[model samples]
Target: MTVHLQQEQQTMLWTLAMHAHDAASTRPILGDRYAADLLDRVDDPPRLGLSLAGNTPLICARAKLIDDAARAFLARHDEAVVLHLGCGLDSRLLRLDPGPGIRWFDVDQDPVIELRRELYGEREGATSVAASVTDPGWWAQVPDDVPRLVLAEGLLMYLDPEGVHTAVTHALTPGSTLVADTVAPWVTWIAGLQPAMRAADTGFLSSTNDLAAAAGAVNLEDELSLVDATATRTGGLTSTAIRLFALASGGRDAMVLRTYRRP
Candidate 1:
């Protein structure tokens, strides 16, 4: 619907764009059925031009990667605890619908959580926490001693380097898992130049090519690439460009998803 959000929160528009795109794609990346239902409820997602076009499929791919990681974590640890940090209006708990044993928390700012309550309802195992992720107070709400799966999708760049470290480091447990998407410095630069971002008064303030290093994770595994998945669906010059960008930047290292094991 017609929810009013601040400039920083307008980034939720990208979730809408990817949702609509995935629903419309021939080979839908994430196949987010819930996304279509939400789109029907929200206002028109603003046209972000090239950034929207390029990032839509990538966002879907990123979501898919996160879903896969969660599924894997859940498969191994039935007593898993999921924390989706900086969770916007997007509905991941509904998409996954983890078991009753798993305690899932969708964390975000008070305003967005308030909006979410109007737009969405309480889930059985999933609870929405209204607090800034940077604030350590909210961290106390989550339980300890479980297979924790912490997801920070399109989040860290909003926080500076120190905030990113604190958020991730706080959740790092020996057996816990962290799945995150980070942009390289070059990608951050391009995002700032985007018309849509400038219009919304939001831009990536922090970026790193190596998320594992930034998080100080002793064990790390690279997960998915936006270019890799999107290139499969692309053709002609578009496909060529995807390929070239990947090669030019060491296989789209600019924007990547990774899973880190807390040692």
Candidate 2:
């Protein structure tokens, strides 16, 4: 399909790439069979170019962590609400098919949602909202009494600091949890140098060591990042090199997956 997403919106391609990678990889980290199925229907080229080749492991690992976290959350709360923020063309709802009582909202802008609808038809409990996640109005549509889990995968770095606060703090209610990834400052700088990012006219805008500015009632439960996963997925000299770099650089200065819970 010849979808016309805005330049910034095109970042969804990376998430789609990760899904495809997982489905296509021999020993898939995510084992997202739904991803490969959806990808075959999307009409976009599935192969990663040299410019974006290196991102496969990083993106897939990030997704694997999120998938694990989401599965754990669903296990705890069978009837909880889930917000797949900046959802792109992801097939997460298919992968983590929650219970009958679960309310899942896969959100994104208009064009992306349009494409998503074309590729994947309507489902029973999952709803697709066509709106920018930065906007708080979307929250009004969501019922507030139940617990919620916000999965903001590969999303925070693209938002400004203010946007991050709005998304994490205001968008979520008390008794909810948010699982998101943020690139450290150096990662932001390096992201600007990436040809694929530059080509999409997209670059990281938020880079904070702490995602706590607007986390009034939330506390960080866990902190996981790229280096934590890169070595596990790589082998031989590459695995050693990644582990060594992670050891020296430590955890705080790398791209990370952070889970926060609201009281």
Candidate 3:
């Protein structure tokens, strides 16, 4: 049986649908081949209009960038811990399939985690924690000793400023790496203007023009422009438009993927 999701939780389905759509395309960027199968199981999947469909490339590109960084981290560390905060129903654990030494944790709200469990049964090295990232107690469930890699893809903006700060500070242990994607302040405002977002009674709660200011104390290790990544992964007019937008000042930061390391 399928589970019911609240409006906010429905956002995960939209992203999953985007990944599934891209996988079926001729040249897929993210190449999450399992996305289509997962999405198909949903009782009523979200229908993507031009606006949402147009974002497929960017979303898939972001996923691809995160996957690459995650794979590299796993390669460098013999035994590691991965905290996928706001993991939703994405098949990241299955996609990466890290070896025995790695302990992977997929964290999310209680309801979302419930559905995820239904979709994905138990895996050897993976554990699903059903709790909010903002809750301090959830941190206790994760080990403090192991080297950590925190992934917060498409997660931070849904949180208010204080929540963002709390989650970040708690996630960054010594020698840990964090990879997250954030939209510019203007995009956050624009997201609020979307009719669909309003209808769903959900919208972006916070955004940061400068991630350094928002994350606090972490050293920025790398940054990738979603626009640039999308351009690189796509072709023809889509690539041209993305490249042109990137050329404009501050355009690359419009939606950025940032990698930070804790000292």
Best model number under TM-score: 3
Q: How much does candidate 1 score in TM-score?
A: 0.92
Estimate candidate 1's RMSD in Å.
Answer: 2.0
- Backbone clash numbers for all candidates listed: 2, 0, 0
Work out the TM-score per prediction: 0.92, 0.93, 0.96
RMSD (Å) of each candidate, 1 decimal: 2.0, 1.9, 1.3
Candidate scoring better on lDDT of 1 and 3: 3
What is candidate 2's lDDT per residue for 117-223, written digit by digit as tens? 99888999989999888798878998788889999988888888888888887555788898888877788888899887788888998865536566655688888
- The residue ranges of model 2 lying beyond 4 angstroms of the native Cα positions read 44-47, 250-252
TM-score of 3: 0.96
TM-score for model 2? Answer: 0.93
Please give, for residues 55-127, the per-residue lDDT of candidate 3 as tens digits: 8999999989999999999999879999999999999898999999999999999999999988898999899
Which of the two candidates, 1 or 2, achieves a greater lDDT against the reference? 2
C-alpha lDDT (0 to 100) for residue 225 of candidate 3: 84
Q: What residue runs in model 1 are displaced by over 4 Å at the alpha carbon?
A: 48-50, 233-237
Pairs with backbone N, CA or C atoms under 3 Å apart (clashes), candidate 3: none
